[model samples]
Target chain A: GELARAQPVSTPEVEAFLDTLKWDKNGLVVAIAQNVDTGAILMQGFANRDAISATIASRRATFFSRSRSQLWTKGETSHNFIHVQDISIDCDRDSIVYLGQPDGPTCHTGAETCYYTSVPMDEPKLLASTLYALEELIARRKTEEIAPGAKPSWTRRLQQDPKLLCSKIREEASELCQTVEASEGMERTVSEMADLLYHSMVLLSVQNVKLEEVTTELRKRFGQSGIEEKSKRPPKPTAG
Target chain B: GELARAQPVSTPEVEAFLDTLKWDKNGLVVAIAQNVDTGAILMQGFANRDAISATIASRRATFFSRSRSQLWTKGETSHNFIHVQDISIDCDRDSIVYLGQPDGPTCHTGAETCYYTSVPMDEPKLLASTLYALEELIARRKTEEIAPGAKPSWTRRLQQDPKLLCSKIREEASELCQTVEASEGMERTVSEMADLLYHSMVLLSVQNVKLEEVTTELRKRFGQSGIEEKSKRPPKPTAG
Candidate 1:
């Protein structure tokens, strides 16, 4: 007679799970603090590998305390715990990204991240990048490296004749003036104007004018009444 | 009478499409600034709305100023214009979200947002929402508000037998201990611990223990050395 056999279980049962489990020293583990808002890594600290362990076990956020030199639960004091949704390490595995919903602001000063000032990107990075691209294209054109294609690259065409870039700048400026006259949806106007300005920047770069130079000149004109600045400028003598 | 075949006719094409648009007097419009990372609305201000119009026309982010009152093109000086990817206005059409990549930090103070304080969230707001949800659930349990064909809620059961909540708390704490003993991925431990802490808070709320009272008591223990604090506590006296 064939006897009915019980199906063999694949996953570990709860009792067996307990036997396989090990112990954490304290409810603490090391945690690296990061800015949730700006995507900037702020500071690093430890949670009781056990506290952190507990946090993960509990599905709440916890961290180790370096100041007390012990495992202390987050939100225990401030009632604010960094909820952990997911964590992943980098290629080298030295750091981690603790991604989750932050209970409140992170920085002790209450700012988003620590590094606020960014002088490195003084000019718009896009404008700078575009300008660099134009310059490189111009240099390539001079060396006969400009490729012929169905869709003519603006830069390649401009490289063939520098005057074309200048004319485009003038055209863009005049177009901007016309757009200003019919003022609705400043959004579109601003967008088109940016294109004009970026193209203008390319022309300027071709002529060796840096963004800083323009900014310096604009700064000199700042804080002065527009009328006052205009009055101080040398006149065109009314063009006869 | 038949119309004569007309020669190819061309309507006027402006040099720049934006130049055809017009703006209002004072050349200013409202630019609503918000924290790019955290979706918090910060203070709003006017841009010469025209200078910004010009900046926008130039494909750069610009703002109108009311004080010096000229259009302040963002990144004009700092070279950090909020790069324009897309722009949308609110229902009333007074404010806007300049949804683009901010080249660098937006705040003048070098912090992320203008509001940098994480003061204790006012209690009234807390009570009306989160606290209210907890209270309503507890009250339902107390009333034994079981619906047709519904699994009994832990809260409802706890309300029926108040001592059971305490027992569960003790049980979870012991389970947490076992998880911690196994030094391993502490994440699971934290998740379980959060449940314990949250449940503990519910019990405290049910028992009329104010959170502030607990916080005040904890504050007293803050600067004391862990060793000193732990040593002073008497160990459980053994029963004869």
Candidate 2:
């Protein structure tokens, strides 16, 4: 008990907690940090004994950087630190999860998390974040070097030429309008929407913006009067 | 249409469009800018005839600033501009919604939109963003001027003391663990959760981070295998 008082967790508390996790052969446990309140899984990393010790000792989420081959404390560079809240192991005990409270975006590219991108993202619930996924991919493409014999991606090519990107957005938007004005139950609208969505993702990617923020805007207005919401806004600073 | 060009819309078309709006006494209409592809509303502003004209002329979102008493283009100073896609008047004609393609976050606080804050937010969808709202509120409290004869808010005081903030978070987190282990569907669990969530938000806000990003991490993992997802991660740079 002496080890548990007056700090986030004492050295013994850290040791006791680490003792519970069933580490892999490499003396590392897969650490998946989750949001404690919402029960939302946040991000995942690897933690060796030292890393786990560092995490509980400091009460910040620390992990073994596989690439660096040493203990790594998240947000060491970006200051987007993850605060360890509660640690739990899976039923099988082969993996561990640290309910981490993150201070800012966790992903390296400044999006929300490291797991934003998913392949074949084809589920109904997953649809909501699809645009965001595309936005992240386009962002990755911006700095990612192409593999030999791989066709150059349009997002990168457009990033090189801003004019084409802007024009493409406008063009796709016009097509969406036409699709909207089409006959009742027009099937073409979905395809047109996909076009617009792709182009808009490209546009947002170029600007280095993520799509989740937009959904947050929508969620804020869920029940409130639009006029009232508008009124509450801090006035935009006027021009000179 | 003098503004007509090889684009999604033309100049005369723009003027004809604005003609449908029933502007208020000051010839202004409330403009709600939305994400064209996602349909998530982005931001809101007031638009006079001149502002609308400028928006069309420049294809940028220009608003009549109430404070400056002049036309202001979004991102004029911050370079976080909103690119106008399509403008449509609401059924009432007193308001308009602009399908905007934002180049960056539209809010002055570097948030995605101006309408992020909500109160007593209780709903299915609102639940996800509620943590974010709390985060934003705590952040605002950090910068808000003290009112005359008002009790100092805990969040405010906690912001002033980093050590106290860290301790408070740890305390609440421990309580949450106890509650979780209680009887099935224990009522105190929710309250403990609220406490932990609040403390976490304060901790994040002090670190200049918001909670929406955390939820995005959850939303992205909606329909995937955590194991497979974990494996796909680009190997963290090793051998530094």
Q: Specify the highest-lDDT model's number.
A: 2
**What is the C-alpha lDDT profile of model 1 across A1-240, one tens digit per residue?**
011111122233323422333322443222444322222333334443344344444434445554565445444554455554444322222223343344664445554322222211123321111222233333443345434554334544543444455445444433433333343344434443443434444443344443323322322222122312332343222110
* CAPRI classification of candidate 1: incorrect
Error of 1 at B49 (Å): 33
Fraction of true contacts retained by every candidate, in order, equals 0.00, 0.00
Interface RMSD list for the candidates: 34.1, 22.8
Task: Pick out the ten consecutive residues of candidate 2 chain A with the lowest summed lDDT.
Answer: A119-128
Candidate 2 Cα outliers beyond 4 Å, as residue runs = A1-240, B1-40, B43-103, B106-132, B145-151, B184-186, B216-228, B231-240
lDDT, each prediction: 0.38, 0.52
**Residue ranges of candidate 1 with Cα displaced over 4 Å:** A1-240, B1-152, B223-230, B237-240
Q: What is the per-residue lDDT of model 2 for residues B1-240, given as tens digits with 9 covering 90 to 100?
A: 123211223366557766866776678876556543333345556788777777666667777876678777777777766766455443335555454567778776776654343211112223123344445556767899988986556667767765565455445434434432333233444444444445555655554433433333323332243312433443233110
Best by TM-score: 2
DockQ, prediction 1: 0.01
Candidate 1: tens digits of C-alpha lDDT, residues B100-176: 34566665665433333221211211111122223444454555656897756555454344355545544443333
